[model samples]
Target: MPEIKTLAGNLTFTECPRWRGGRWWFSDFYTHAIYSMKFDGSDLQKEVDVPSKPSGLGWLPDGRLIFVSMKDRKVMVRATDGTVSVHADVSAYVAGNPNDMVVGSDGVAYLGNFGFDLEGGEPFSTTNLLRIAPDGTVTVAAEGLHFPNGSVITPDGTLLVDETLGNRVSAFDITPTGLGPRRDWAVFGQPPKTMHDDVFAPDGCGLDAEGALWIADARRGRVCRVKEGGEILETIEPGTGVFACMLGGEDGRDLIMCCAPDFIEHKRIAAKEAELRVVRVTVPHSGLP
Candidate 1:
């Protein structure tokens, strides 16, 4: 593990961190805004305001910013001139909030969502992994996912999704029409039997150059660098609950983590303890975030 350092602090809750065009960009749930800042946390700017709350972030081939409007269950796009519009609506296919997403090289975005009312204490259920084409066509990419959250696309075109409640990372081959059959990329243990079972609840993740994944273990309050077959290469205890992470810097080796005291909606909405932390690692980033 490398030395952990704070890059930014006093946020409400940060998610969907990304490094692009020489700056760090992320969504603050309680603040209802997206922010960008330099590597050292200087030049901080609020990039956009998303009233429905934003969760995932990505870019189109033509440079438009596409993001998940979590509450409305829609994917919204921002143009270079700062025009925002709904790109695709996924409310017809999901029951809970759409969380994280990974846009493929060809401009197709695969999105994940919470299966039930997690904060409301509803019974756990499964949801679909959705595919949104560049033309705004919405379809189901995969199904029966247990709270699909953070996702990444490998150089070889494999989509790896972190199933937070499943206790596993699921993989799928990115095909022309949609995704291939689902398989386990990494399994920390059996699928969680209930909400309180001790498990490795992976949240947001980033892929390293060596094909390993740096996963925010939401339930453990730590980040684990894991290999394909379930081997954890490194464990980073940042002393807070990490919900999302990204690998990006001038050299593409900086691991940026989204940290907070906890993930409860009421607690996070009432406080400003969320932070962004960084740790430099040996491996650079690999593919789509």
Candidate 2:
């Protein structure tokens, strides 16, 4: 394990860390801005602002950037010239705010939603994973997911979605018919038996060279490396809130983590306390997530 180091700080809840274009890109929920900087943390640049706050980040095969506008439930696109526009309005399919998304090699995106007002302390419910094709058509890719949070697409064309409230990572085969029926790829903790919930939780994750998952469990104040069958291989202490993560760096061994004290909506929307930390591991990353 490599020593964990702080790469950036003074953010109000950073999520959706990504390694792209030779830099680290992430979003600050409270600051309403997306930022990018060198791996050493220099040349920090504000890439964009999302009045509704941003969550997930990805890019199309054409090199256009896509980001989630959490509050407005919209998927936004940023062009090469820095022009931001609405790619699609998802309010009809996902009543709750959308979260993470994994853009496939073909440019199709599979995204998840909260399914409830998490910050307002509302009751939980099962949600759908919205599938948006390159042409901008939106449809339900999969459903009955309990707070589908982070997700990954393996080289073999399989989709693995982390059910944060369900205590398990579910798998689906992407086929012409659509995403196959859900199956368990890994299981951990004793998740609530019901479908409506949040915080039963494994918030964000990354896939390794050997098919293992590096997960950040916000509720548990820790991060864990586990095999597909749910065997815990390693763990990282959470000095603060570890809400999201990404695997990046030259060797793809850098474990980029999104940390904050907590994710209380009201609190995060008002202060600056989030950070980005990096921990290097033996295995490098292996897929689109």
Candidate 3:
């Protein structure tokens, strides 16, 4: 059995756990804040606060941090002195709020959207992925996605995007020009007629050195380690709300999770309780943020 441990708690909805510079960086969704802490929970610091909600996180090779300012449909770059500036204005292409993002090795960032006004109780819809180059150029990477959420880039430069409402994970080959084509990397459940029928609602994801994906299944309350074509290798139950996860630690085998009682914005904000939990795994992390 994998032994799970709590690193921090009493947060306001944590998502996007990232391992960088020997620390864990994440975002508190409703609180509109970004944070970083040591693996043992020391030296905790609030990095930045977005006026709008924040979710996915990425970093350029030069050490600049970029986070998805969900409501504004923009990715903000943070300088060393704490100056946050708009790196990409994606409003022209995105109809809904941006969600998870991954920074490619080529300094390109791929972002996703919620595809519907969930907070406003709007019906679900399909959205596409946006590619933001280092030069701030934005273009469509993939389309017709059912709420693309967590994503990661493999050592070979393949992009894996988890479609939360679509019950599948999509794959793409990223190049200097743009993405090549879309393929089904993993299919956990059947094609749901509607988003409401999704079973393994894959959320945030992380890649392991062994080419396996550790995905957070929100509706099922577990972190599932799956291989190509949707083979379930293992499952880690957190017994709470698991929104996102990452692999990082001294040896890079630490599997961390963002845990709370629920994902509803009202409940998370009102409850004011979330935690970062970790477990030791055999496979060290591999791939881009």
Give all candidates' CA lDDT scores. 0.92, 0.85, 0.90
Candidate 3: pairs in clash = none
Model 1 lDDT-worst window of ten: 190-199
Q: Which lDDT value does model 1 have at 130?
A: 95
All candidates: CA RMSD (Å): 0.9, 1.8, 1.0
Which lDDT tens digits does candidate 3 get at residues 1-289?
7789999987989999999888999999877899999998889999999889888888887888999998888999999998999999898888689989999766799999988787888888898899999978999988899999999999998999999999999999878788888999999788777768897999999999999999999887899999999999999998888989999989999999999888887888787789999999999999977
**Scored by Cα lDDT, where does model 2 land?**
0.85
Q: How does each model score on TM-score?
A: 0.98, 0.95, 0.97
Question: Which residue segments of model 2 deviate by more than 4 Å?
Answer: 189-200
Worst 10 residues of 3 by lDDT: 188-197
On lDDT, the candidate that comes out on top is 1
Q: Give the per-residue Cα lDDT of candidate 3 at 172.
A: 93
Look at candidate 2 and give me any clashing residue pairs. 124-196, 125-196
Backbone clashes (count) for model 2: 2
